[model samples]
Target: MTWAAVSARRLARHRLDAPATVGGDPVTRRIADVVAGTCGAHAQVMSAAEVSVAMRVAGAVRGDVRNALWRDRTLVRAHGPRGTVHLMASRELPAWVGALGGLDADRGVAVGEPYLDPDQVAALAEACPGVLAYRDLTATELTQALADTVGGWAAEPVVDAFRDHLPRWRWAQPTLGHRGALCFGPNRGREVTFTSPARLLPGFVPMDGPPALRRLALRYLHGYGPATPAEFARWLGAPRDRCEEVFRELGDSVERVTVAGAGPAFQIAGDPTHHELPRGVRLLPYFDVFGVGCHPRSLLFAGGAARRALARGQAGNYPLLLVDGQVAGVWHQALRGRRLRVTVEPLVRLSEAESDELAFQVQRLAGIQGAEEAEVETGRVTVGPHA
Candidate 1:
């Protein structure tokens, strides 16, 4: 078969392998399967933070709270993948984080924007002792508490300013609801709302060196398999050679398949089943890995179409509505009276049937996210629990 047909088939298979895919197993095993099945039995790695959060949410053997550091002995950490952090299995860190360059300068892409400069970060570390709960510490409280150690820097406004570097900042609250909301929780209303990094860092699985690289390649390949080195590099924010190295290491473990409609793609030896076209719509979170993973997103959407929709910042900044496995529109949600209202913004004009079909999908998403009901408005769609 021609490459396009081969790629299309691979794309279909990829849709089948995605985590939390619809109609899949409904057990903790499914979650574990998502992490393990994507790579292999030996490939159970995730960011320490991501793992901690995942475990807390999943209610693994330990209680939801995490500790200050995952590995108590290590003073230095080998963060991996895109210069950000991941909780790889202990065995995976040396090969993953150690192989790549350390502490990337492009904090926005890697470490994130509001990253604390050395002094400030150090101050944060030192202040951890005085910190009671993760509740939002006013910059003043943080500043006064750390004044001796941090020197002249003012702490109050600095805290607010820090937000520019770290948009996800929130004081750990005493209630579980606060903590869950800060992170992505399956359902709402738990206790221990405010959280500190300490509460979620231990679960970090650090993978360093070549093993890290190989694991990343395997994850990307399995999750987005049937892709080329270029595609993998773009998603990884790394070089093509690095991507190829990982693929080479795996060798025959990954099955290389050429797609017909989609061109060339790859797939794991055995993936779970998937749905046919019109599989249903998904409202993906902003900066969702899917969007950033594949640059020149035409690989998934219509060619030249992704950049236009994504460039808008506002529309591109929020959760997206994916219809039929393609990012067809953008959506937002707000609570209204007794229901949730959802606004849908289509990148392209839609026919009457298409609009109606999209509205139905938005309603479903609202229900899943805990809205009582849903309403759709024109121009832009907003999803809320009230009318």
Candidate 2:
């Protein structure tokens, strides 16, 4: 196999689960993947349309939209990898929290802005109910509530007050942001709902050290298997040996395979040929697992692609556009007034055909995201400071 094939195979294996088949129908395979790999984890940020397509392709529609919403797995807020919300697996919560021990504070504030003090943050934690639903609260309302409960401080002031505190735990998620609510509810009637930090805080739970780390290792290998101890350590923010222990426990259940040209590859024992590669277009959200699961860059993108993509610090600030299993460009969308603007920052200049293709894909994505209309634009790409 050539380098591309090897790369594709390794990625497919690490990201995909077992007893599955690919190369059949792209739509069908996609559904099987999102459901199987993440079912125990819970419903992620999949657009309603994507879910619908998968449901139709899989031939498994149990009820109407309302029922489907409820039937969907419970989504929860999680922390790890650059201090952002991730949709995490519920069954895997304990392991995730334990693994994330003490790294919470490193996440920093939004853009590293200093906000929220240790004592005040602790107070917020204490005041926080297990689950909080603002229903529809404006910034003012949220601030008012916080002030009412704690020293009557304003929201921004409250946040700024405790920016120096550090976290006492880490999460064990292979990737982050897959276990949270589907989307942020719009501001409504000065009240909105959200999962309280306390309910999702792993530090609240008592855990044994080694077992917790071991469980985290197993999940990472399961979802992002065929990986080395170094790669696992980078993703989990743990020591390499800790990850090795879990890999050791799995034994020969995992097979060692090398890309035709790429280095050694380890994956669950299964023919990767079973997975299909559809030309379907996807507007992967920021911090998509595919990019976050491995390190050393080579695992996902070509030599420099990973470094470039993540140049904006570890937490990716850009959304990548993938075409035919390669990094085509980076893109983002904004709904301004009545127009939907889709911007593409290409790593390389695009041919007319490539540009047109990108335009079409962006249009479709914008529609799915509930935009009234779409316009496409391209700009020079950059790998700069995350700040």
Candidate 3:
């Protein structure tokens, strides 16, 4: 297939280098629309999730995100791509559940056996909905209920499991919600609880696996396109063979493109070509979709920026500082009473204009966090506890 050559700057511009101001039919009015834009916003770090949404939507407060998740039910918190906690649009639960939950079977006994014997996992899957049906219950409460329903084995916690992996339940909890059985309820202090999506959402309809995965892949390419199957697989945390199957399924709907230095990539057919390099500095929160979604890290975090911005190869360890759409450095914020101190550690010496832009970005970050005032300092600073 012939590939259309494109520049890295153009690719970055197309991906919303200035993410705070994404252009399209403005859906910032609805939280679901914002979440759907990036497919899903990372919520593994709650503060990061709040900042991610707040930055995208005009006049949006952190409480708005909280209300959307807990009160309005417009967004659902669940294990999404890469088996990480993400805030997905409630209406898209069916597609997300189908796409992500289907991976459980593909993972096979090798992954599942270590957590719980296949039989135990099966039993818990069968009993999970009932245990969490009408009431929002905590992890402890759910474990006890599962134990009561399935047996003591259901309460056993798995070793080396990521976030709240005890009881060895399936990754996509929204899958249960898609069955009209369970949804995340408001937290009781620091403890999260679950109830029924049917009761909470009222009009959610579950989509089947094939269509759901297809829709997800298309949306992903649309938002972070000119991307590769390996990038897709890495983002979804699914087997590469399965991801390639989806790519083949896309076929004529997506056209191949050549990104400068990054080789071949794919984008939705008929999407307009962009060549403008967005001008500005942006302070992206930890796990911000734009930073975490793209692949070929060497291109995005080129030169010494990668070494300074990332701890090892992990992306979310620190908030990112972007200049002209490339990772330039890392930043951290310290709150002292009403004043927010944002310290930036740039890997490269920035121009005076860029430093001014950084100051503006710091003020924006302070506003997102609802700080009364912000102080921008250029120096090396330690990563905060949030990491």
Candidate 4:
């Protein structure tokens, strides 16, 4: 198949070809639907995640995402795929934990130093659920509690990410989540807190290893299939050989296909979805899941888009303007109280219809952010990546 067909299918899977209606679904369910459909959202910037969920639905706003996350608890903040902050639908999180435990099993992923032994890491992971069970603890409080629960080694400031040294347990927090122990609790004041999924969900249990990994592979193929194991590894932040092994285990469950630009790839054995032309104009925010997950970067960010939309070959750093399922430009938005000003710098001139769609996308953005007024200017976006 051609790259165009692949892009179209991916867009349709993401519900980006057209806005999907929630119908009579409540706000929480709507948010979870979008989150699960996108395979989880890049939520380093909480507002970006809210926009990511809101933009895919017919009528959702940022406030709805918060209500789902905190009020209804339909969605939970987890350190998910790629060890980044993601807003995952609560129900699907166990499959992620079960499938994604491959990374958690690797003690070297966090650090391969003697200061943090695999046994110590295991102890910390075991201690998390009990300490955090039915309670919320800020980073500082959690680390101290963990140290008290496990050993003083859990609190030693050995791992360094920020200017100050952080405890190994803190550095390996994401892995703990995959172990079915850690998840983000609501913020206490300005500080972030961690909670146990066991307490959050009624009966949270990590699925069995091999089958869960297969489920994850199937999910990946469904959303971003006709992709290679290496691409899957890149997306999962796991070893390529391990991913290739998963594909091998699946055997005939997936069908191998030759994508024109992407070379040999695989999709679920019997994909019946129709691939139509992905025609639309979408304004995607920073760390949008689609921009980050699409494979064969050379095709997605073709020609000038590579230089304009990406930062050092990394996706999700710049907001993207998609035209006909391709990166057509870069965009930025500034919210000033009730007003939202959007600036788009397109690599190609948008047709009248696409221009209208872009305006509608701007309106969607304004609605999601609860801005009273919206403005757009199609010109050079004078900002660098992530600005």
Candidate 5:
């Protein structure tokens, strides 16, 4: 019922308390478990996602994530929650693909006149599976192929690129991915390539949409439990009504709970209601699932932590400093040749032991970044939001 108890369970579920370990090959399987346990790892900056995964698994190191992703084929990078890239468990990707594809495509930020018509969405989604099947293609190549198949309308650079120009087909890639028609292939030299789930897991087809969404909803509740439809929808970038439908579909699979700070919410049936008091200091990288999924803003981002750590209420805009499951500060890193420089700004005062814990995390971060050593500087973070 308390936020602390919920935080305790979440940390343990995420394997932050005891870095995840699996029966098979030490690093690869553990990497899969870590990704699967947390639903997925935000992979827009893959190296940081690797850091997120590595730091959660005992003795896991750099290259391990890439190994599982590209070499062992245990993980698949794809468009995941919130129309962003993520590393998902390859074996479980079908369900993820099904669940993601089930979200009402017209309900997100790109809705209204600016949004593509269903016919256009169908064209782009249809072209992706065959265009990228069993082959990797760069954005330009895919755009050209879509134009060839669907005409110039799909190729026009009409979409808002945010940072750069994006053709209509490229803009629809995320939606196509939700339909299991598109995913990330291994990078070709410096350029990124696209592929499809059909190519990745050839024999299997995706689970049905409703069932898959229910399955994912259950898992989400287990991982980020006692959460609201709005939060779940926010995470998946779906409309709140759609999430409410998914919740309703769950029916007896979930039950209502009144969290002390979070108020009324839904959690998986028969899940643990009581959890141990959370302890420890963690240096969570930007977009770390744990940081992004922290709920009940008032409790987890208490007082100064809110003012200091959050970037205009966005959780993953900056690296997080966690003290006993609450955001306590912000951190940023820069690499100098072989040495990694980590600067932390703790909003709350740290005891001597906590400071040492912070140092250990710095060392771990250096190792994960493939640096020879690390230097820690404790002071104000100086940078503004999204810096």
Candidate 6:
């Protein structure tokens, strides 16, 4: 089959939903769909994760995301791709757990000679579900419980060994939902807690690894496709050799495509060829999946946008300002009483239409943040780290 040729501009528009205006009847309604679309929503910065979902789902507020996580049991927070905390749908937890569990296992081996021996790690892992089986407990509480149940070593914060594993051995695993053992519970006071997914999301079944990795790779392509195996590996924090193995298994299900001005890439066989570039301006939250998910940094952040939007080669340090589907500037929001002050530092001058669209997006942002009013200030052209 002849490979389809796509432009970076069209890819951005398609991935970011550029043409769609805000405040419509929501292109995505369910919180699960929102999580699935971008593979998983980045939740390292909790507020940014909520805004990322709110931007796609109509009539969704930060509270809706909270309810889905804590009340509805539709979404669960887990350590996902790239070893980052992400909001994943409850139903999809099995596949994610399978794939990420494999990766974590590989990681454990690569790190070599665990602070706790195999038997000790195994013992702590075995004890974790029992300690957190029915009820949720904060990190401190969980740590103490593990120490009480497992021993003094479980309580020690083994920084070099892996900080995430300190509280409980199961925490070291990729998915807490694997045995329906745990899910992120509501924050108790200022501390986050974990509860049993079995209680929260009944009928949870973990899938096998091969099929789960296939599903994960497909979802990654669905949102950030026309990509390379190396890129996928980087995104998943898995070894490139492993990614290549999975891609080979995919076979003709994915096709090699040539991107204009870029080399070879791969996309799902039947993905849409025609995509409309988004118009006007959009405000993308810090760690917005669109900005972080796409690979070949050169293609997405070309025209010096990378220098302006990224800090020290790290994306998501600042929120992005998109003008016609391209990273044109960076923005920051501050709340003063009932009003939100949104300051934009553009890399290029904005046209009147773009400016108008920016103001509209600001209002939409204010609504998402629960601010009654907003003030948008577009400043002088400034690029790079300072911007």
- By lDDT, the best candidate is 4
Name the regions of candidate 6 deviating beyond 4 angstroms. 1-15, 18-29, 111-114, 160-181, 380-387
lDDT string for model 1 (310-373, tens) is 6542123445556555667666656565587766676766667767766765554444444567
Clashing pairs in 6: none
lDDT of each: 0.42, 0.45, 0.73, 0.86, 0.84, 0.72
Per-prediction TM-score to the true structure, in the order listed: 0.54, 0.58, 0.88, 0.95, 0.94, 0.87
TM-score of 3: 0.88
- Residue-level lDDT of model 3, residues 1-387, one tens digit each, is 211222333334333344434346333336677678778899878888998887776556688788888767778887678767788888888888777666666665644454566566566667766666577899788878877887876666654455644555543243343333455677899998876655566665667777788889998987777789889999988889999899999989998877767788888997776545446677888888877886668877889877777777767678888776678888888877778998898887899999988887777778878899999888886865245
Worst 10 residues of 4 by lDDT: 106-115
| Model 6 C-alpha lDDT versus the unseen true structure | 0.72
Model 3 / residue 32 / CA error / Å: 2.1
Off by over 4 Å in 1: 1-205, 255-278, 312-318, 347-359, 378-387
- Per-residue lDDT for 98-193 in model 5, tens only? 887766444544432364677788778788888887589998888898899888888888777667667866657777887888889989989999
The clash count of every prediction, one per candidate, is 85, 49, 0, 0, 1, 0
Candidate 5 or 3, higher TM-score: 5
What's the C-alpha lDDT at position 36 in model 6?
75
Local accuracy of candidate 4 as per-residue lDDT tens digits, 1-387: 888889999998898998778887896897787788778998889989989988888888888888998888889999888888999999888899997775567535454244566777678888988888768999999989988998887888987776888887776677777878789988899999889888888788888877888888888898888889999999988888889999999989999988896799999998864567778899999999888999898999999999999999999999999998899999999999999999999999888898898998998899999998998999998888773
What are the C-alpha RMSDs, in order, of all predicted structures? 9.8, 8.2, 3.6, 1.7, 2.1, 4.0
Off by over 4 Å in 2: 1-3, 6-73, 80-84, 98-218, 260-262, 271-282, 303-308, 312-315, 348-356, 381-387
lDDT of 1 at 77: 23
Where is the poorest 10-residue window by lDDT in model 6? 1-10
Per-residue C-alpha lDDT of model 2 across residues 167-240, encoded as one tens digit per residue: 21011111212122112222254453344333434344424545665656555655555567777777765556
Off by over 4 Å in 5: 22-26, 105-115, 162-164
Residue 371 displacement in candidate 2 (angstroms): 0.6
Ranking by TM-score: 4, 5, 3, 6, 2, 1
